[model samples]
Target: MEKEHRAYKSHCLVLPYPSQGHINPLFQFSKLLDHKQIKVTLVTTRFTSKTMHRGSSGIELEAISDGYDEGGIDQAESIQAYIESFWKVGPETLAELLEKLSSSGCPVNCIVYDSVMPWALDVAKKFGIVGAAFFTQSCVVDSIYYHVNKGLLNLPLTDSEISLPGMPPLEPLDLPSFVYDFGSYPAFFEVVIGQFSTVDKADWVFCNTFYELEEQVVDWMAKFWPLRTIGPTIPSKYLDNQLDDDKDYGVDLFRSNNDACMKWLNEHPKNSVAYISFGSFAQLGLEEMEELAWGLRRSKSKFLWVVRESETAKVPKGFIEETAEKGLVVSWCCQLEVLAHEAVGCFITHCGWNSTLESLCLGVPLVAMPQWTDQSTNAKYIRDVWKIGVKAQPDEKGIVRREEVEHCISEIMEGERGKEIQKNAMKWKDLARKAVIQGGSSDKNIDEFIATLVKR
Candidate 1:
């Protein structure tokens, strides 16, 4: 009877930051826990929950009001104000939800919260539940933030080139876009820095990356907190080729028009299409957008581009009609499915960690143009550490011109550099597969995490 009662304690609440990038990996983690027979409840904002495609799955979907459920932080006065509101309102609602769960007799045993939402840790502690911080970004970025919290690396860094305890030397250009001078966007830096401060409160620190990918950063991070690698938290179909009943993550915020994209790719020759997407959030100026459109047109390579409906207005007149035969543009896509296509020769990306991992895992080289946040850092790893991509340098106005874009597209498709990058991508692909299989690094780490949770 005691054992039977203890078995019911395997319920976990997953709280991801309400964004497409943050939500996807945590959703994958929830599915993984469910595979281990742990009951999972994924919490989302009212607006985000409505947008997500929560099909039949073992994980229960729960919604919490984040004040601006309709417009989200976009409706807030400022970024600082939005964050303040999120922290203020989110904890209260989450606490109430926990109480409701307890009263219903489905008490949560563990609360796995996105590291970005550090305040959630406090909510979990208040409810006397085990708290774990899940970092959805690269381990190197986490390590950089950890150093920044320690005051070892002063921001608005005095020296242009800065070296940290475990990471490669970084230039101001290489740091996450949020880490500007003290006078500029201080609140953004504060919020990012604050994430590390709450780490000691968490029972475990989970990274959505494998050991071989960022070994030094992971080792350095473990010294501070109990850490584990249970990623790349991608769908099983893509990673291990597991043909489970529920293979897709089924959490697309936008409708995935994959059928058209995949059919278009089928028409192209193998390794022929240059796939372009700047992630879901990053915005481009009209001038830059036009430049990219012209560049893709001039490059003459067959391509697929994912741009927002709003941003599509910025394209130069007749650009799409001119390239209709050679190009395909869509508002949103099932990115994993697109990247895994055999015709995708290279990726032109914003260097978001998800895009980075997917490209590398599928053995597709990159043409990196980092926009903001951890993107520049991820680009640094791609161009410098991983050697599986090339960075597109912006011009005097910080815009990647048509010439540069055309050059990068051509460079990655043809030449010796492209060959070397392809080789590296294939190598990383093999390593990524090894990390997810039975008895592999990620699998063992996940098992250890479950054992610890059960023991607690």
Candidate 2:
């Protein structure tokens, strides 16, 4: 190793897809690297960078444009237009940013990028820095994508059940929404399918999941590439059972109402509250929103919901007022704190991977209401493979009715089924914690990965 490299001060430029789900894990991973005494810089799109709360002391933050930074690709006409605009501008912009960073004394030794942006690997290779693909989603989902790209699995799936080696059988509904309806989201479908083509070109690959949690898929992927399990990329405070001081990831795309939500949770009886959220991006139809409202009220469970302020218009006019005593609705809250709270018995979620892992790590059972993308696969794992949650099935019209929602809520929060799921959830929580502490599976993987990075 050269003198600078011999010092083990590897500087890594981390780039995450600009979405809230993608940014959080990469940012947390950056913090972990900084904690390990590596120089870290997290890069995001200009718009996402603006929304982040700058609190982490050791990490550097930077931004590159995705062309439509003012409001992001939401302003574009379609998914195709949005992504095309991103490709037209993102790669060149990122290349310039890396060059500037290198010339200004912080030469990057490696590039760790979210797999969604496969084009980043090319840019990193051009710069002669090692490229590592970081998956913000589950290893199972990534493996599924790999199969799809390899033409081993067909899309708009014809079978009621799709089987993959080492994973539970999946129904069409269990696959990502994009798989069934590619026409409506051609750009997103393309990006997801194309990610694997360049994934093998990278020096290393990381998943925000622990080996114990998805051992089958993690092992399956390692046979194909230099894949490593180095996560539950949540804060060490939650996963490692460290002190509460390390809780916040220090970046919030949405403003949080932490104090009010925490206070509401505190007043509930132990393990009595049903915490509901659909993550940052999923939007519900007005009919579906009204159904969920009535369902929560009918279940008569103490509930805390995080609905975006913009979506509140969909709720029945008198719904919030009628359930005032039983339910608290906020625009957003610190999800980790709420999930960690003693009163939270069940999480009614859209089954996003981050939410899935968080619920598992904190021992909160789930009411899976998967919406789109990888959420469906995540919901499948929660309800079937893990058995720590119940999947809320929708009707023929694709609406999860109020009665169905109520039934699921009751079963997961009050029935014998709830007790079983809760026990399983707690078991997984202990395993997740074990995988993150010193000498644990995830910790050891991260330690070895860092050692490898320094040597490179």
Candidate 3:
């Protein structure tokens, strides 16, 4: 008797929690799966799905697929509150997609879940699909995330010093944005953590950082969760496709540039350029913005500043004219490429997760200027954990001063401390490369993951 036939290729759905930081990594992991010849079903909120799949450069998640719906924040306490509450609809939305694909004779093999969302595991179990968790932060941060809810945040002592396993204990002032400030307005930390029900229950967990980048912390998390570190994913992929002959990747359609910035960098010496960006989500108050401008002007360092159109950015009038000759302000530039450029010596950043990882992988030290959300968490790691960056303080209105900014930049670039961070950053870079090589922990884990994902 003849047996029924199986599908042509294995397919896995990759879903990020729907933010630029989440979207970028999920796209990388999905592409990595495709590279291994597995078919992909990339999932996103309706809006992000449109943004991510808008290119011929990679696999696009089709809206025509069944169960596809417009993704929006739920009508909960707040959008941040909605992140956790949205899980109630996860099973339903996922079911629609599954039923649609099955009806079309294509059954999903497994799921690659974002570690932040635990509900993915439940949906995976319902369909007998393998649930894989893709962790977006470094393992150092991961260990903290896994434990912060377990009596850490509930510590009764005010301004208590907390010690992470690998580094020295930290004061409340040192704890970046996500942990302490979450009690304040519009905090996602409270909601997201409460709803982190799916990720810890997964069959396999994948991390975006390579093993060596967070070796000690990665090793520690392995006992609690089935962990795999597979990052420097963005830079790793970028290096693969860049051509020696091409001037730019031509992915510039997404970027808006103001080129006077590049011209300023051209005039500066190699490794002398200070590139300033507060990252995708970090914001500055009006006072902080002007102070930073004046600080950059006073530092005597040739600089490139990225002016993102965020709600918090308040640019003063006459500012452009005052600093135009020495400083270049641009909407955006090819960030990874710019960091990798020899002209970039120091980075002034808000320490978003991606920016921290990217700058670290490129061996560039940072002058951390974290604003809110996970920016503080990332800043803590960059400043306290990694010893590769310096932190800038926020004022009474929660804005840091211009003189302090100038002093901080000078301290990082020309003083004895700046030299130290540069040294440490290069050390991290060497290990990052080592981790991506064959037989390395990250390399082995990625190979094993793709094998299981495609074969099972």
Clashing pairs in 1: none
- Each model's TM-score, in the order given? 0.95, 0.95, 0.86
Q: Between prediction 2 and prediction 3, which has the larger lDDT? A: 2
Q: Write the per-residue lDDT of candidate 3 for residues 1-456, one digit (tens) a residue.
A: 111242335778877776667777777666656655667777766544544424333443643211224445423455654554466666567767777777655578787877777777787888888888887776666666556666655533365787777656776655645666545644566544543455656888888887665777777778777887877666344333321232232222245553555556667787776888876556677778888888888886777888885532476777777877667777777687778878888899988778887888788989888776556677877877688988888778777788777877787778999889989998987777667666666667877876776666
Q: What is the C-alpha local distance difference test score of each model?
A: 0.86, 0.86, 0.69
List clashing residue pairs in candidate 2. Answer: none
Q: Let me know the TM-score candidate 3 reaches against the reference structure.
A: 0.86
Could you tell me how far off, in angstroms, the CA of residue 268 lies in candidate 2 after the best superposition?
1.3
The global Cα lDDT (0 to 1) of model 3 is 0.69
Candidate 2 local lDDT, 1-456, one digit each (tens): 132343336889899888778888888888778777678888888877776676644467888988878887777787788788887788899899888888856589888998988888999999998899998888888888888899899876788888987788787777787876655577788998888878879999999999999998888889989888888888877878542357877787788879999888888888888999999999999888988888898886899998998888887898888899999999999899999999998999999999999999999999999998999899888988899999888989888999998899899878999999989999999999998889989889878878988887
